[model samples]
Target chain A: MGVKRFIAVLPQCQALGMRVESADHEHVLFSLPFAECHIGNSRKQLIHGGVIATLLDTACGSVAVCALPRFEMCPTLDLRIDHLRPAVAGKALYCRASIVQVTPRIVFTEGVVYQEKGRPVSRAVANFMRLGAGKTPVEMDEALFSPNNEGEE
Target chain B: MTYSDSMAQLVSETQRSGHWETLLEQIPYAGFIGLTAQTLGDEILFCMEPLESNTGNPLLPALHGGVIAGFMETAATLNLMVSLNVDQVPKVIDFTIDYLRSGKMKPTYATCILSRQGQRIANVQVNAWQKDRETPIATARVNFLMHDK
Candidate 1:
C-alpha cells in the first residue's frame, strides 16, 4: 500500500501501453499512447473505449494507494467513467488522478483523460476497499517510477 | 422514426450483412483479447475466450479487471454501431462501470441495450455474465455522441 508500490505491480498497464508521466505524494499522472494494437475500431480510427476505461481504472486505483495510510492493496469496489469525447487516434492521451476522500475502510478518487492541453476527453471516479493488514509505510518516492526527469522525458 | 422501425431495420441489415461480427473482428484490441461477436435475433452477444495472456491475477486465475471493462465497453460500442447502422464509430461521451464480481478463468458473455437516443447522443447499458443469465458479473452505462452520416 505504500503509494509507489501499487504502481509498480501493474503489468496490465504495460500490456495496454500506459506509462506514468508524473507522480507525487498525493497526485499521479498517467499517459497512454495511441497504437494500432490498441485501436477499438479500425475504420473510424478511434482508440478503444475499453483502453480508456483501463487507464481510468489504474489511475484511480493509484490515487487510492497514495491515499492509503500504509501499504495495502485496495480492492476496487466500483468505478465509473464518463467519456467526454472520442479519443482521437494518433495522439497520446494523458490522465491525472487525485484522492477525493479517504475513510478508514475505503478511498475515493477521481481522474481525467485528455489529449490536448486543458481539454478533457474522459473522466472517472472509483472506490477502493482498504485491506485490514498493511505493510509499514515506507519511502515511496524512489521506488515509484522509471527514471525520467520531470521535464526531460 | 419509431424505435420499432429502427430496430427492425437494424436487424434486417445486420442479419444480412453480419456487420457487428465483422467490426469486432477488425478491432486490434478486440483481436488481442480474442473477442467474438454473435448475433441472436435482435440481440448482439459479445464473448471472450479465456487465455493466459488475458489473465491479471494468476493466483486467482481471474481475468484482468481491465480486460472485463474493455470487453464490456467494446460490447456497448458495437451494440450501437450495429443497431444504428452508422458508418462511423460512435464517440463515447461517457461511461460508468460497476464491477459486481470478478470475472474468472472461463468464457464470458455480454449483451448491450441501446437505452436512449437523442438528436446527437445515445446511451447504452451492458450486462456481462459468466455462469447464468439471471446473474451478471458487471454492469455498465455508456453514452455516445452519434456521428452525422
Candidate 2:
C-alpha cells in the first residue's frame, strides 16, 4: 500500500538509483539502471556481481516491507547469490521477490534477475532476521506469494 | 580500456606510488565506494570511509547491507589479486554473506584470509567489524575464478 515508503526510508537504496516499479499486497518489483560504477570488468563490460547481489537483497527487503503487516527491523541473516551468467552491460536488470515463508523470527525469500527478454542472469535466496516489530503473527496472503506472480517492474 | 590496460595501469601505480592503496583508486568501482587500504605489519586492513552516499538506513544510521557486502567482496578480490601475484582481475563466482549485526554509521574495517588458492580458483574468508574486532558486524566467504593475464 505504501509504495513510496521504501525510497523515503532507505536513502542508500535511493542512492543506488533503484526504481520501484510496482508494489502492492500481491508482488514487488525493483529495477536498477546501469551505471559506469556498476561495471566490474571494463573489458568484459560486466555488471559487478556484488552490485547484482545488492539489488537482489534490496528487492527482497522491499517486498518484506511491502508485505509485512507493519514496518519492522528485518536484517539479512544470510544471503546466497548464484550468477548463472555474467550480467551483460548496457541494460537495466530487474528482480521480483516474494516472501516464501514468514515466521515470528525469520523471513525467507528468493528472486531472479535478468534483462529485458533475456534469460536469468542470476538467482538468489535470502533469509532475514525479523526484529523490533512486536510478536504479532503476520497473516499469510496466498496469492501474494504464488510463484506465478512475477515479471518486469 | 580492457582488463589488461587497467592491469598495466594498476601495476605501474603500485610500482610508482609504492603503496597498495593505489589499487583503491585504479579500480573504478573501488574509487566510487571510497575504500581505503593500509598495511600494518603482516595484516592488511581495508576500511570503508563513512560517506553520506553509502548509508543504508538513515534511521539506524547503519551502513547499507549491499555496501557492506560490496566492501567485503572488494576486499576479498583485491587481497586475492595481491596474494596470488597476478595481474588479472578475479571474477567472482559466488558470494555468501552473513549479517551478524547492524553496521553502524562509522568507519567499518575488514580483513580477509585467502583460505585456499589454486591456479584457477581461490577462496577468501572475510570478517568485517565496525567498532570491535571481537564483535564483527558481518562475515563473508567468497569464491572467485582466476583468469590469466
Candidate 3:
C-alpha cells in the first residue's frame, strides 16, 4: 500500500481524524483538526499532551514507512518527545517528520509539531525496529492494498 | 470558586474517597480513549479496555503505538496529580517511551512510579503490560511541570 493509503486505513488515525498533508521519501507532514474529545483540560480547553504525542508518533512512523524501499511493518522501539508549549485550544495541529538516520535494523526519525508555520509546540525523536515485508501479515496486506478491494478511492 | 480552587477540592475529595474514576471523568481525552483507573491500596492501576478504534495493525490486532503512548502519558499525569495533591493540571515537559513489545488488542494496564517530585517539576516512570505484569509491552518516563496555583 502507498503511504497515504496506509495512514488512511489505520483505525486509530481514522478515529483521530488525522489527515496527510504531504508525504514523500524525505519527509511526511500530517494535520489533526481540533476536536472536543482531544481536550485534556476541559476548563482551559488545552489539547492533551498525549494527543501531541500521538500526532508525533504517527508522523514519525509514517516518514519511516516512506524511507523504506518497500512498505514494511516497522514497530516503534522508543520515542522521546519535548513539549515546548501547550498547544493552543481549538486550533488544528500540524506535524512534520523526517528520517534522521536509518540502519539495517532501525530507523531513527525526528519531528516537530506546530499549529502555525513557525511556532512549534513540541518536538519528538523516535526509532522504529525494521521488520521486513516478510513480517507483513497476508491478511493485512490484502485488506489494506488489494487493488480489487471494494471502495478503492 | 476559582477553577484552580475547585480542582484542588476535587483532587482532595478524590484522594480522600479513593475514587479516581471521578477524576478521570474530568479529562475528556481519557474518556474518549476508554481509560479507567482502579486504586489498589495507595497505588493506582490504569487500564484501557480493548477498543477496535484503537487498533493500528488489524492482523496482529495490536493497539496503536500512539494510543499506547497516550495511555501511559495520561496515567503518569493522573498519578502525579494525585500524588502531589496539586490544584492545577500538570504540564508535560518531556516524555520518553520504550516499546518492549507490541501492545496486543487486550485490556492493557499501566502503573506509574513517581520517581521524583520537586517543587515545580515531577518525574514519573510508567510501565504498561497486557496479560502479564512480569513482561511489560512499553515503558515511559515523563517529566511534568507542576503549575503554580
Candidate 4:
C-alpha cells in the first residue's frame, strides 16, 4: 500500500496529542499542544523532555515506513537525542524531521524539536532496522506501526 | 540543615545509591540537565523543564511523545529505588505511555507512585501535568527488573 493509504488506515495519535501539520517528499511536520498539566515552573514555564522524545520516536517511525517501493518492514534499533534549548511554557513545540538517507537494511533520519519562535529544543538521530516479511505478528507489532494495532502496551 | 541542604543531601542519597547516575547518562543531554529529583514521602518527585524548541507549534506549544517517554523512563527508574525499597540500579523491562493531552511547553512534574515492589520486579505509575494534575499531559505504567543489594 502507498504510504498515504497506510497512514490513513492507522489509528490516530490520540495519546501523544499528535496532529499532522504537513508532509512532503522528504520531510514531515507535526504539532502538539501545551496544557496546564505539563507545566513545571511558574516563572519560565516549559514542557518536559520525555514528551519531546516520544514525538521524535513516532515521527521517525512514520518517516521510515512511508512511501516505500516494496513491502519491506522496519523497526527502531536505537534512538539518541540531544537537548539544545528550553521550550517555554504555554508555547507550542514544532518538530521538523527529514529522512536523511535510507538503504536496503537501515533507515537514518535527523529530527529537530524547536519552539515556533526560538532555537531548537532538541535534535535526534534515529536508526531503524528493516525486518523481513517472515517475522511473526508479535515481533512486527512491537516495532512496526500496524494500522489495526495499538502496539504492545 | 536547611531545605537546600536537605535537597542536596537527598540528591547525594540518590546519587550514591547509583540509581540516578545510571539513568542520568542514558537520557539525552537535554533531558538529563532538565530533570530534577526530590524526596516526597515514600516516593520521588521528578521535575522537568520544557524546551521551546521541543514543542509541536509556536503558537500553542506542547510537549512531544518521545520526550515524555524519556522522562517517564527516568521517573520509573528513580521510583524503582523506592518501590524495590532499595537504592540500586533497576532495569526497565518494558514501558508504555498514554498521552492524555498536549503537554504544555513549560515546567512539568511527575511523581512515581509505586504500585507493587516485589523481590525481583517493581511497578510504578507516573502522571505529569503543567498546572493542574487533572489535565494530565501524559500518564505511564512502567515495569522494572530490580536486583537489590
Write the residue-wise lDDT of candidate 2 on A2-101 in tens digits.
Answer: 4445454577677667888887654688888888888766666778776787888888877766667766667788888877788877899888878888
lDDT of 4 by residue, B45-141 (tens): 7887875544432333445456667777677766664444443345555555655666667888887778887878777888987888788777877
lDDT of 1 by residue, B27-79 (tens): 88898788888887788888998866676645455677778889988888778
Q: How good is the docking of model 4, by CAPRI class?
A: incorrect
For each candidate in the order shown, give its overall lDDT on alpha carbons: 0.75, 0.76, 0.87, 0.61
Between candidates 2 and 4, which one is better according to DockQ?
2
lDDT-based ranking: 3, 2, 1, 4
Please say which candidate is ahead in DockQ: 1 or 3: 3
Tell me how far the alpha carbon of residue A116 in candidate 4 is from the true structure, in angstroms, after superposition: 2.0
- CA shift of B107, model 3, Å: 0.6
Question: Model 2 Cα displacement at A44 (Å)?
Answer: 3.6
lDDT of 1 by residue, A1-153 (tens): 233344444556667667777776578888888777778766557788778877887888777776654456566777888777778789998989988988888888988889998999888888878765433233333334324423233
Q: Quote the RMSD, in angstroms, for model 2.
A: 5.6
lDDT of 3 by residue, B19-129 (tens): 877788788889888999877888988999888988887767788988999999999998888877899988899999999998888899999999998878899999999
lDDT of 2 by residue, B1-149 (tens): 86677776785565444487656554566666678887666567899888787887675677888888888988898777665556777778888999999888889999999999887889999999988889999999998888754
Stretches of candidate 3 exceeding 4 Å from the true structure: A138-153
Local error of candidate 2 at residue B54 (angstroms)? 1.1
Predicted structure with the largest DockQ when compared to the true one: 3
